[model samples]
Target: MSKAYNETVALSQSGALAALRAAVEKAQEMGVPQCIFIVDPSGETIASLRMDGAKYLSMHTARAKARTAASIRNATGSMTPEFAVAAGIASNGGVTNLPGGLPIRFGGKLAGAIGVGSGTGDQDIEVGRAALAAIEADPI
Candidate 1:
């Protein structure tokens, strides 16, 4: 028998940091405090940050949003209610239906995800999008 291996890309610390900075900048621009979380392709945390005055609960929510994005391989906000029910994502632990989560892609492959919290859903999503744009410029 022959054995084969699967190769996949993962987010690097530098990339995560860049994304985090972008997210923070966006949050600042929007006049909102935030908690940002980034995870690897395997749904492992790479880096996280909580801006001053950010809600304490946002810390856990941000990580959960990142985990959800990594697990579903899609933006958490994009998951429809029906899809969430069909996929049982609504019942999954550490998975959120929040709008802050965004999947990170590299070379057309899923590399990881980023999540932002402590702002309104739309604001959080905006921060996530900014983070994604920064990450796209320096894909790891």
Candidate 2:
């Protein structure tokens, strides 16, 4: 029988953490406090933080964002709004279905995800993207 050999995998959680810090700092500098979340490949929370001015609602949004990214393995925006609406994605019991959730990919493999909330959707996404970029994790 032929065997399927697997290559060793590597990921820089440190990179992801660094990215989170940088992104949070950037948000702070912009005077936009936010809730940030990071998750592992399996969608387990790795780290999370809420800035002083972040909204309480963002706590749930942040978790939802991370879950959406990990479950779909794509950026939250990847799902067209039309599809999201049709599928009730924005409704209760559906995915977060917002723009602030982004999947983390490394070496063509899903590495993890990041989510941010407590601002405009665009702003949340920007901050999350900054962190993903810092970690060198490809955004899906």
For this target, which candidate reaches the highest lDDT against the unseen true structure? 1
**With candidate 1 superimposed using the best TM-score fit, by how many Å does residue 132's alpha carbon deviate from the native?**
1.2
lDDT of 2 by residue, 25-74 (tens): 87987789999988876668888899898998897888778877877777
lDDT score, candidate 1, position 38? 95
Per-residue CA lDDT of model 1 for 1-140, tens digit only, reads 53222234777889899999999999999999999999987779999999998999999889988988888777887767877555545456477787888888876677888888999989898899899888783232
Model 2 per-residue lDDT at 43:
67
Error of 2 at 37 (Å): 0.6
lDDT of 1 at 46: 95
In the predicted model 2, the residue pairs found to clash are: 75-140
lDDT of each: 0.83, 0.77
TM-score of each: 0.83, 0.80
